[model samples]
Target: MNHAMATPTGNAAAKITRLPFLPLASSAVAKPRNSSRANFYKEVLESARDKFTRAISFQSKDKDISLAKALHYVAAEDEAYLAYNREIDAFALQNERSDTSSPHDAQGFEAVENMPMDGKNMNEWLVEIDAIAKEVEAELVSRDIGCHLAEVLEAVNKVLFETRGFKRSHVVVDSKCLYLHSVLSSGSASAILLSVIYIEVCRRLNLTIVGSRVGDEFLIWPPTGNPEELFKVTSGRSLFGIVNGKCVDDPRSKASDINSSSLLGLEIATNRDIIGIALANLIRFYWKRASKTNYGLMLTSPLRSAHRSEEKFSKDNCSEMPLLRPQELRLAIMASERLLILQPHSWALRRDYGMMLYYNREYEAAVQELSICMAFAPEEESEVLEPFVEKLHLMRLEKSWKSSLGQKGRLTVT
Candidate 1:
């Protein structure tokens, strides 16, 4: 129980306070001369510049929260990229203006550089979480809690579960449980999110809590302790064990037999892996919803044989799911893409992404992705993927041909 309390690391707000302002105007250096195309480029750059400037001010400072924010931005890549471009444009603009601007203008620009970015809507959850951790820390200090591993953990549990009322969501498909902000507000989250909260709060208290994926459940324990001893801690027994349906009656005897093997089987999750798992869960949830539609039917159905009815793609039999929400497919794709960013070389992930694109009617991109999968996927997987790749190529060709015919018909009408 005589555990040492580690030194507290600076939070996101503290880090933000130390970061210098981004030099926005410096990017306006290469102002394009007036022309239709140049005008378009100029407008785009200006818009992107403005958004990027705004986005930078709101970017999350905490690592895990930032990754969650990144997942949110995956579906909005166009906006994120525009914001990125804005940062570049601002610097160019500022550099161009610096030489000709008067002393007063220069002074004003310098003053702008010192101002902190607005911290309102974008990832405000980071601030709220920081506040939660601080509150826990203050509580522990005010009560004169010792640095014993069990004591600090009990204190954390009291603040989070009893006072704050955070609980586990029983519904497996609940999307709200997957998001950090939703979990914070709703007080119910999936195991991974709860573990994240537990880890983060403990981190602020100078304690280390590490997580492992045990079977389908994510379990956490202090970095240094007897696994069974820590498991006896009330929070561990109730919150982690019972919630996961792995609780045992007797502490020492049954706990050891059950957890001993689980302890050995535990695959320690890195921060990146945890984020990837969250996105994977989202992909699964969205895909489940999407699969009920004709457009997403391929996910549940077997691949069509090469000789199977050509009438499948005929005008009267076009694959369309009027009942399916397009947003669900897009979300599944975005979640898959975000997971890929964390694990780029995973051919299984690439294959899933390719399939999502195929269902979304992006045949060309699907073909490209599946082709990559075919190249690297295991021979067995490649055999399964080859048919999708071939079908996508045919679909791409048909789409192009139809487009050409439509254009010709339009010309004839004109």
Candidate 2:
């Protein structure tokens, strides 16, 4: 454990302190769900709750325990987090028709509570996702002779995105439904979210289609160029592995040994990376909301102008942003907290948390987090936080000055 990992994690309501964490499981595979998907989610939820209850009770029973005991407590907390997160995802499907707020509804704290991952919702989601995956599988299965990779690609692009009318959201990328249910319903998503859809389909089919990150752009494997080259790989570790079937990465093989065709530009996005990106997208949405000093002014932005004109406003929020202009930093703060939970050693995420604290006017906490971020950063990336910490100190001083002035002004008024 690093020095920073020892810090106790206090919630937003608690004073700023170090948050202790369990080592992230390299891969926490979801247990295979029964055909009864509803029961599967219910079982997961119950299991998580039982583990949480046991952890607390077990601690009480073994009060004078060792470090390992304390570790057990942390493990249980994480297990609960895993289950709760799934339950939370289901809430996204809640009456999209009734709660027809603008896709760009400046997500706040309430939105955090909306993502539920219960049995009922999980069943619906699996069915929807499978509906798309099954067709592609059937197509591939029918072709006993190897199907051309272009044909496979065309089938995927056609069924998932084109036929279903999935498109990248215009102007303001609304991340409201980038997850399973909402994405299927709205068919509007970002690149990473779409990649998830693609990846999931590939997983079902045992294909090796992966999400690739080349600089700023996110691309999926097997690019559209040169249709002649995209033959479906049979056995023996071919470059273009089956997308929806088993992942056959030659773990022992060197990069030099692998086929060049497998390389899709630079970095292949990991499962952790994909999940982290989704959380970051939500955080980005909230961060934008926090940055706005005035919702009235923001409503006038050209990005949202056409949307404004297209719809009539309800008496309450003008049907614009139901969750607009979060005055408190709750959503952003929560987002940063989740990011930290997911990617603890991530200096970049720590910096994001530091900035969130800065924006929330928790100057001391902000400085501490930035300091930790600086410490955690890799040697090559060490300078990333030098300028950040300096700016934070200056801001702290300025905040002190402002506080003094405010106190003096209040005294004078009195």
Estimate TM-scores for all models: 0.65, 0.49
Error of 2 at 204 (Å): 0.8
Model 1 root-mean-square deviation: 15.1
| Tens digit of per-residue lDDT, candidate 1, span 94-176 | 56797643212111212111211222233466566777888777777988967766666767877888889988664666667
Per-candidate local distance difference test:
0.56, 0.49
What C-alpha RMSD separates each model from the true structure? 15.1, 15.6
Q: lDDT value for candidate 2?
A: 0.49
Worst 10 residues of 1 by lDDT: 1-10
Most accurate candidate by TM-score: 1
Off by over 4 Å in 1: 1-120, 232-261, 292-323, 410-414
Error of 2 at 65 (Å): 32
Off by over 4 Å in 2: 1-120, 138-148, 222-228, 231-265, 294-324, 327-329, 377-414
